[model samples]
Target: MRHPHTRTTRRRVLGALTAGLLCAAGLATAAPAAPAQARAGVPGLADGLALTPPMGFNNWNSTHCRADFNESMVKGIADLFVAKGLKDAGYQYVNLDDCWALPQRDADGKLVPDPARFPHGIKAVADYVHAKGLRLGIYTSAGTRTCNSAGFPGALGHEYGDAQQFADWGVDYLKYDNCNNQGVDAKQRYTTMRDALRAASRTTGRPIVYSICEWGENKPWEWASGVGHLWRTTGDISDNWGSMLSILKQNLPLAPYAGPGHWNDPDMLEVGNGGMTDTEYRSHFSLWSVMAAPLLIGTDLRKASPATFDILDNKEVIAVDQDPLGRQGTVVSSAGGRWVIAKEMTDGSRAVALFNESGTAQRIATTAAAVGLSDAPAYTLRDLWQHRGYNTAGTIAATVPAHGTVLLRVSADPHWAANPPAAELGLDASPLLEAATPATLTSTVTDLGRTSARRVSVSLTGPDGWTVQPASATTAATLATGRTLRTAWKVTAPPGTPTGAYALTLRADYRSPAGERVTSALPLTASVVVRPPAGTSYLSGLTWLSATSGWGPVERDTSNGESAAGDGHPITIGGTVYARGLGAHAPSDVSFYTGKACTKVTADVGVDDEKGPKGTVAFEIRADGTKVASTGVLTNAMPAQPLTADITGAQVVDLVVTDAGDGNDSDHADWANASVSCGGAAPAVRGD
Candidate 1:
């Protein structure tokens, strides 16, 4: 992803960011930035294009470079945008991604639209889109050839020429792709196009929104603010539950790099696509809205049903994306499949998502204090999707269907907290923690209050003689309510820290939002028990799972329904106990005996119960980062699939249960009699 902002543009952005903090809070909204008159206020710079995440219709997802997406199709989508109420909802750009050009450049080395497809050419298409009160977008590449594989040559050596040609054709947006660039530096090649576009704009007085699509490998967010309006944060997204969720996991941490004028693009919206269920689609839209992602439409407008329009044209949710504050929502709390992601809205309120990633209906609840809904005896909550309102001042509770979301806009009076702040601490130990080796200890400090908690600090207390790092840790900033701060400490017990089950006193010190000093204490007990020497343990117990408690409660099953409503009966081998979601995303982990290499891992796995949720799951085993083995798309009624993987020379083995094509709701996946064998590198279970 190329487009680097100019020096002056960066200065203005940084200067304006000084007030961004206020925008991020519910205190105020940032004014929309004014575009620079000249590129860089100097000469040639691709200044203002998208003051917000550019939204519009893109034909690639719905048509995928097929022969059908032509001038008529593009014009039809534009008409639908107006007819279906998409135009007034802030979705204006009509972008053409890949395969839009002739296979070869003209004899004069100029690019041209395919005659067979557009008969009248791209200029006519742009005119049609402009006539409909909408803007038209075109596509190109940074390399010698485009990503279409058999598409036209890129703008590589013809940046200026292509720029001039596009200007002549009256293109309003450019989707610059990355493919076949003969080893040219990504930044250099992209910057070349930026200048090309700037020259065209200055000469023609028409601005084009440049989208950098380098696919996140170039760390575009690190240097891609002013260069373009938005940059893809990851690889292209597939139309499936796993692809959507996977991209989200990678894009969530890039939130800080997104704001007004520039954004972290997680690719286009796939709302009406048939890959995921309605519930999953809601989560997709809800996440993109709160995360400040570009709200581009990637579905066929003509075929989109009313339900699809309901999701795409939700004005209330759209307002959050178009909020002048331009702040992305962050994950405040996540446990099991229940997640709380919150965004501070402009009107001293908040837009929140209570998401259930499980396969069954779950009780999603959170207190007003958790989201900084302080100083109010009561607050009004508006359901964004259902278009209804509720009054609540305590815990906001709802039963979200499997893979469903309960999205709400809370109007809370922002003020100092009137009640004492509550604190929660979670302790996690290293999977390889042994008797003599130093292990990293992680602890989280959460302020269960309705306002910001100030001067927050936490410490862990164990036996007096234990070896612990940084006896205490202080947060660099005040803790926002519902926000959890994780601090890690290196701890070691020399067989003298009073072994066995021990309670760690995790105490916190903080001041109330009103500046009143307060102190809180919470205890986390982890067995200081000795992990048996190297080769003596199997992953037969919950203690072996790396993050057992991070999710909702997971139960070991003897019979399928023992944990939840599933039909999985433990395979009669190895051990009667099998691990499944029990209505949760049951992710488990185990380490090989440090003394030897794991030769192989074996398991009999099947989808938990198809009779009820019929949800799907994939069982994956990875040693280090190498995927050693996996059972793809496990479903109910399918015989237990036998799997094996060579984890040779690996010290850790991880079993990850992921949501199948559907959401994780009722995805009761079972790994019966799962175990790994140690051999080779060490004393191969000596045949004494």
Candidate 2:
């Protein structure tokens, strides 16, 4: 066959012979973003490792070790996954979280399956998973002890050997946790297991997907890409709306790190959990799809109701997940609890999601033209959950439910020939009613299979008394103007922009060199809030910064009841201090609720002046502990400087600051500012 590049090669040779001409033409330039290539599927797994997002049953949040982990229960769920076509939909991995391991290892330094729950042994169970065409996943900690207090006989000094055993047992996915990899960097600890998995894979001749369960310690995004397929980006998500929303909010900053080869894990799904309503669960699924997160179901597949299955099986909704684009959408604009986001799909289509996250329903209106399309292309508009299709003019006026979402897949309208346009321009899902930036008015013109436009001109009538800046422009007739050339300008925070919602007339004129003129006018609107209205605080009282999960620093303080005992109650830490909720329990047997960031921590020890050790308090931070902050001291006088320390990726450190005194009135101590810096932390793994 003739080589197609021969002529191009000859041209290149001639260009080499005529370098000046080639330079003058400027035809050569670096390729844009490396010619979009097909992404290789996940490593050491089938090509469809993540076809539609991993979905299956989990032990925690559902079974929760509540006596439902028997072999029959596992097989029953497996049967349901198959019967529900979940496996056919690409939900293959059946994962187990903490609390499944036995309390002790055998005499040979090997993990022993709990005989009471698994008489056939874990290997036999894994065989059952493979037999059912589903892969098996298991969880374990890098520490000597598991999160649920089960001691690992081989975990203390046998991480690699243990990984080999998991591979030997035919485990396909391993959620390696950071329970007690003390004195080691979190990245290092995870890396240790990664290497172990590789070695084990070599020995067992079976590929395993290494899942780093560091609980968002360090900043997983920073190093997660090269280390694991997926990393948890937030603490465990609960079945409540607050938990789901909080995890979503926490993942916003980690978007840049998500891609085809890697994902951001917002923990597991709580679709069938009891804390939230069906609407909230739908919202959860909607947001997760938008965020491109892994869809690991933490509910019992066998017991989920019809509503749960409906939410999970909506193909329209799942399309967002399976979209080859693999790009997570971002909130382009937000106002008054309303949000507009844009997501790019693999098929070159964009999904615009308009949502009302407030307490009541809101009217979401937009023009296809405003969303940057004119003579609007054909669109297949459907409510993802409702599965109803509505074909209409360029404008869309949908009454969006409160805390609900409207996802629209907008593309070139193809049925224009069949349906004559009554208007010159149309709007798609563009939230023109809530424009947020000066760039909102920007629009991209389509040539419509014809020559491109030379110049495009647009104009807007001043709103009421408002004035237009740099108001007018002249352009070549390339744009068919009458609204066909989606043209609009975003409202700016103009010096005198109004303080309330307002609408104005927008006009566009496309003139050809031959003197042909096309003009059109439509209503353009926007909201201008000089300052955001104030309301009751969403989060109340003292908010302590949480320590990073896995390993990091712990800010020390000696104020607010620092004693030998550790109480989980909130205490005032001087200076600005924070603490993350480390998985480790407080000495007082209570769980700490730090608000995701802090260096200093305090305990709630009320005034006990009569006690001999009135001012006595003690706090500790260890390498094995998840939160890491510098040691802080509290005194009656003199300024205190922050303690200097280095927290390499994933290393655990103990932080302790205390105030103690013998029986005496002079025994007084004040503590504050207990927090940890995430600079040296592991990258969070996000599954979008």
Scored by TM-score, the top model is: 1
Write the residue-wise lDDT of candidate 2 on 1-688 in tens digits: 0011221233234335544432353322222121112122223223334433455566677876667776676777778778887877667787766656677767776787777777787788889988999888888875555555333432535666688888998988878765544435777567666666767776788777767666676777778666677788765565655446556667756777776646777777789776666766887888787777777777887778998888777767777866776777776666644666666777655566777554334555565555544465444344566454433355543445545677776555564333222222323222222223453443322222121223456555546544444322323346421334554444454555544446555554443333444354544333443211122111112222122111112222222222222432332223322332211111111112222222232322222222222233333443323434433333323232344333333222333332321111122222223233432233431111
Cα lDDT computed for each candidate against the true fold? 0.66, 0.51
Residue-level lDDT of model 1, residues 451-539, one tens digit each, is: 56778887877656666676345573687656777778777766544334444566677776567776655444434433323331234
Every model's TM-score? 0.59, 0.55
Worst 10 residues of 1 by lDDT: 1-10
lDDT of 2: 0.51
